[model samples]
Target: MQSKIDPDMVDLNERHELLYTSSPIAALPIEILSLVFHEVQRTRRATGKPMIPHVEITLSHVCSHWRAVALSLPSMWCVFQHSYAPWYGPVRPTRERLAVYLERSGDHPFDLWIDFKTNEPAYQRLFFPLLEITLPHVHRFRVLHLLSNANHPLKEFVEQLASASAPLLETCAICPDYSHTSLTSLIANKADIFRSGVPSLKYLRMDETSMFGFLPPLDSVVHLRIETRRTVPSWIPNTAFDAILSLPNLETLSLSIELFELQAFPSRGSVPKEPIRANKLKHFRSAYVLINIYTLSHVVAPSLESITMNGVDLAGLDDRPSIPNHVAFPSLRIVAFIRAKGGSHGARHGPNLQKLMAGTQNVEELLFWGKTGIEENTEKTHCMLLGTDSAPSPWKKIKKATLNIPFSSPTEILLYHQFIAAKPNLEVLRVPPRCLELPTFLQGVPPHIDLRAIDESEPPLPLCWVPGPDWLDTEEDPFLFYCRVFE
Candidate 1:
């Protein structure tokens, strides 16, 4: 065994050992290296970018020890995203790469996303084969996202998912090509795809029309978001509303209604004797484009603590409908009203707005956007809320208030100043940056109040209220001011 060793070979081995030992990254433990690899994958996902095979490929190439560790960890290679980019040419070669991932992932659950950018027959021919190879592994799919055209072979994929026993499936989002108009019909016909047997499925989001035909039990679903398209009217038939109400465990509900075309409402005789109640619902938000206020009167949640209404028209209807005076939201605490343009008129000044505010008397936080011409008469409009008279005011308990609206006339500015000066226990008041620039805006504020300006940064922090350093110039204690933001 001690034959004359080649001096050249000994020199090469020594050089390799020196390089490995000198590298600082090589000193890290295998667990740390694995975490670094996971972080690379997470960064890609957070940016909504397709997963690249180079991460694991490059890590394994670093050294023999690294290669062995990367190969042994299945979780690091479990997420696969295939984005169809026309500029990348043909994606047929990626199938082989996908196979490598499937082999390396071993028994770990997988998260998969396929984004289809084109519907050409040639491209479909190249893409379907990869899907066929991935179909058998559906049982391991934990999160799946499907984006495709109407004519794509999604029907076959849905059929496979229906029959496949996917016990680990948790979240699934199916979106059609944005330009396609047949989404409702396409989803309606596939009613049986996720009808039963998926026990772990929870979070669900879909367009409003997609739920018109059929839906899964969705008993375990905690959050539900219904997005209404501009092309369709935001009308949920009684049966559909009943179906949504059946989800006993639903905690948060969001309805994004773009527009509401007038439809014949049920006659007084046909109105339900008892309003539907959502006992577990804690938060509710609705964004409307000319909706009938009476339509919302049918839904009543006793446990709701927060309510937000955007662009809702309570006074636009020619035949003003009334919300039953008896209906009360006992647990409601926070309320926000973002009035749409042309939404405020002479008719809304008194009964309409007052009635809505009177229902939520216990609200401790109120956000009001009063930019319309009708709101210029702020003194008379908000007089009911200032607790100036003997009548009980719902806004008396409001501790935090945000006013992100225009003040065109001096009278309007003066009226708003009076409004803020009236709240006795108010601790925080937030206004637009422009409002702070007004000559008399700060002078009207009480010395005890913490006045803050809204920072208009990109991706605006609508919920955050922080006292700026500029507040120090006003003789307010810097330590007493605090900043708070909401999710």
Candidate 2:
């Protein structure tokens, strides 16, 4: 049986559409209407995450008028997510679809994320053609992320991308060859691939980058991160260290490269006669980077405001920086000691800690996170910060300290009383309250006291306590920490 169209219902639908169009929002200018869609795009993009096409597609499908407006905004169509990863839901667009999106993206810098993990030859049928199509427009790329293995069959393709001049490239993250290729095999290296120059490049992250001799274009990078998970010692030559420190724009530098030697700037056989200054660097975080005393003497970050060191000696008695910590990091305000192993084995671990902290005159905050290296030595660290007659006091400038040690031992639990007793001039101290039996902890602190309340009108207290890591259950779960402000 054929269905019959009802004229009355059709007329009702037409009237409904007409009434919706007459609303105040529908009368908005095309430019203003575009912003509604643009905002949907910008809200997520501003977070530095990959933009999904669903929003743009949904908005365009709302109506014919909306479709035209969505199509008009080039940036709304700038992202090409080509992936086979389970996390990204596999975005395998045909060559025709990619070409259309590229043309519609206008001259705006585009972002391309390609993750091809599978090694099957038949699965990569479309990847090669799409890659070829994007090559001609590499200069227009703003961010290019290529995720693949060390011996990915498309290495030559990536090598071609390395040679291409990406004048507008701002961030590029890709796995380097990772072939365990050594410096002696320099001929097999692709470190100098961006030889054509990526002038606008600001952030560059890669793996196994120690084999690189030098790249003139690296001076433009502002944030450089090199992380390798392998146990092989990364050969960071003095020439390389000197070159990296010389980067005038380097701001946030992180290196997890292996440091096997103790020499200051160890190369084939050379060391910097004087300290190399990373004047523009503000934040430096390392894992096993400052293992040796001579390593600290080679580079000084004058503008460093924060430092995070892993596997470092909490007691820097024997391996004190050739230059005192304060001298090397004058602007440092934040310091975090993560997983620090002890240096010299002796009594006065507290004094040794005080000595280790002598140079942090300007430090305002300290975080002792992870109990791996410092769990057994917490009392010593706490005693040093508490400041006994023998050990010098913590810097007067320190306003906050966090003890994130997940300690359960009866001996370590006693340190809570130590923190409560010490008048270290800290306004706020965050401790894991679970360490203290909740009832006993509650009895210790006054109920419903605001730490921020004490000010000029009210006399200030020398110290205050707040439960940290935000795990507590009370009547009002949000602000239910029984806090205290007292010396």
Query: In terms of lDDT, which candidate is strongest?
Result: 1
* lDDT tens digits by residue: candidate 1, 445-472: 8888888775544212222112222111
Candidate 2 on 240-357: residue-level lDDT in tens? 5566666889987765555323353333335667777888988776655343233345668778877666433334345333334434777878776554433332122343244346
Per-residue lDDT, model 1, residue 337, is 56
RMSD (Å) per prediction: 8.5, 8.8
Report how far residue 160 has shifted in candidate 1, in Å.
2.8
Compute the lDDT for candidate 2.
0.56
The whole-model C-alpha lDDT of candidate 1 against the native structure comes to 0.57
Error of 2 at 432 (Å): 3.1
State, as a TM-score between 0 and 1, how close model 1 is to the true structure.
0.74
